[model samples]
Target: MSLCQPRPAESGYGSETSLRRHGSMLSLTSAASALSSTSTSSFKKGHRLREKLAEMETFRDILCRQVDTLQKYFDSCADAVSKDEFQRDRVEDDDDDFPTSARPDGEYNHNNNGSKEKLFSPASPKGINGIDFKGEAITFKATTAGILSTLSHCIELMVKREDSWQKRLDKELEKRRKVEDAYKSAVDELKKKSHYGGPDYEEGPNSLINEEEFFDAVEAALDRQDKIEEQSEKVRKPRLTLASPSDAYSTIGTHRFANKVEETVQNHMAYSIQEVGGDANWYYGDLKLLKVYRREVEENGIVLDPLKATHAVKGVTGHEVCHYFWDTAVRLDWETTIENFHVVEKLSDNAIIVYQTHKRVWPASQRDVLYLSAIRMIPPRNENEPDTWLVCNFSVDHDDAPPTNRCVRAKINVAMICQTLVSPPEGDKEISRDNIMCKINYIANVNPGGWAPASVLRAVAKREYPKFLKRFTSYVQEKTAGKPILF
Candidate 1:
């Protein structure tokens, strides 16, 4: 019999048996085809899942979690660093306390060589990938000078991956990693994604089997801080007081001082005069007037205008006559303009008292300030001139330190100056631009104009404007160089 030939079931076997045998073979082939299709479907599904994961932003979420964990770790570690530095300083001090004192007996002898000092270096080792440092020593003053140096060094410590750490960085990193890994694992198991096709991690925080439990643990370990601030004095601030400023001056106060501010102002005035060799607040040229103390020098008085005399000690010009007459009366009468201050607290033999010095810059070099109080060539010769000196009481703000030891600062009043300078023509009232200029020009003494009015000064000094401008600029430059010089 041929193997390829179809067998007639009727020849030797029954037809039902042959049909059943063929049916069984066809069913087996169909099952094999179905199994192959099912395997292919499973393989395609797996490939698609792997591709999706590769493109997905799961790592971004991991990075943020890592950063948050890292931030907490850094904060904790910084506190540890501060405590460690303080302890180190204390240990160093303790070591120093041992015996580095002078020998008994008055002198260090010439023949003896000093004993060598034992050198000690407590160097701070790099912390964890060098992030957490373990009992590392560092320079206390040196480390704080730079802001970023410690941060850079600490970041490297994190990557050190050291197995043994008193406070391990990897342990913290590992915790962060577990958090990320667990999140990823949960995402893999979780099927529902948001409309944005990314996992809404916050919405499914409970997806993690132990998320709440982990969160509670971290919350328990968190750290924090608070501070109290001291208030300062301003215009809006209420009045304050001082009890005994003479004994001890205090920069800070708990409760407000009621009369302290007024006392300080009075003290400021008295102290300013006393500091720079001034006995009393009196202006003398024509005559002398004292407040608490009054003294007068009558000898070698300035002569008044004589009969038709050319270039008399007293000037003939109307303005000159006024000055000459004024000087003679004040000096001859040996009495103070202020009646209450007539008593002499102290008397000076010299007649040239209450003198004022002006700032004069040298022509050759602008920087060279030739602060001349006494005119070298003037008639009544001043003997108390220093080689290099500066004028005192020039700046508007008395707080600024003057350039030269010759200089002192003081505050003057504005109204006194205005009253002395501007004279009304019998009864004319308004202060015109010309009237203001005449008043300023004739004024004998300067009063306290705390900050000079730019408008008024400019208007008054308009004549000889060129000379005034140079003087003003030089004054400004010198003042600005010395202090904060706030406007």
Candidate 2:
């Protein structure tokens, strides 16, 4: 203002544009100072906010993990409580509660000399001998509620059990695989040591085994003998308790289930049945096939008419699959009298059926298969066995996954799996403590009745099953080499 003066132009207020610019610059400088202070405060606030956000995120992670852990515990506890409740309730129901009702007299007492008190009991317990007959109906409702509560408990238990079984099945499969590998390795090592005649073999020309190995083998044999005896004792205890399938009808404990099955059968038939008969394809086809193996069962002559069954076919289907081979046997013979055999048998409670056949169609490879299956007379445990002997087997197929297609779901059940990791069979050794075990090799070597027990078939079914099937199918393709089939 002191140094510069604007030239007048019409009416001078120093040049209007210059004046306006000065004012604008002054306003902008004031605004800049105010904005700078605001920006510093905002930055401080944002920094504190970021720190708080980070802490909250950490807390959230910890909280989430804790919640997940608690949920798992709750789920498990709920299941345990439910199972306990159901068991307690079942025992309670069986022991204490049977549904009871009183018939009405169809009369109301008008007499007021405490007669009404007798007829219509007080709703509230006013005295020692008072009865709340009016609340009887409520008591029934409460009983029903208890049942529902027990049911909820059972549902929780079943869920836990289902999860547990699934895990066990997985674990069992892993254990079995490990055991099979160990077994195979042991056998293969023995074979190598025996046939190849290693340095471990005796130096003498005619020596059967080195002293160390011979002693080891003897010890192993003894241990196996001991284990088998122990197992045999356990089995023998139950052998006496083996009840016949015929006695299933007479058994008093099966009253609930017996009535249920009979009712279902009657409903399916649309008429009441005194005694039910299951599907009879078991014996009808046995007669048709027994004509081939007549010489073997001459001691137990064929009798077919009423088809009285020993074991129930309500659980057998191996006959149908065998019938498939029999119906197709004549057409598929290979070059030799020794047939290339592929055989499949279904297990009692399993969904997957197993098959085994020869690879080379002759010689040591497939020769044993025919020998194994030569006992055409059904195994005693099989349904086709005669009614003269009612034999029951207790061994369960502990391997394999649960059957996806068919399984029991109407009730809850628990099955526990225990695996035994065993050492090699017989070898001579006398050291007492470290290597001693119970005996089982005698049964394995004896090949009881010259036929492998059905248990063996079950054990071998899953492992190497696919390979056997593939090889058999390839063998069949090679054998049937474009021979024209008119069938």
Best by lDDT: 2
The best candidate by TM-score is 2
Q: Estimate each model's TM-score.
A: 0.12, 0.16
The Cα RMSD in angstroms, rounded to one decimal, for candidate 2 relative to the true structure is: 43.7
Which residue runs of candidate 1 sit more than 4 Å off their true CA positions?
1-55, 100-487
Tens-digit lDDT string for candidate 2 (1-487): 2112221122222345435544554443344344334434444454343443343343344345434533453454445445545655555565444443434875543323342233223221112122122232333343344334334444555676799899999999999999999999998576435543342342223445544444444345435544654564454421111111333222222322334333332332232111224643322222221110010111122111121111111111222212222222431321122223343433221111222232211001121221111101112345543211111111122233222311111111111111111233357753322322211000011111111223322223222223222333333333333332111
RMSD of each: 42.4, 43.7
Report the Cα lDDT for candidate 1: 0.26
Q: Rate the local accuracy (lDDT) of all candidates.
A: 0.26, 0.30
Tens digits of per-residue lDDT, candidate 1, 107-148, equal: 533311211111111122211122211111111112221213
- Residue 484's lDDT within candidate 2 is 28
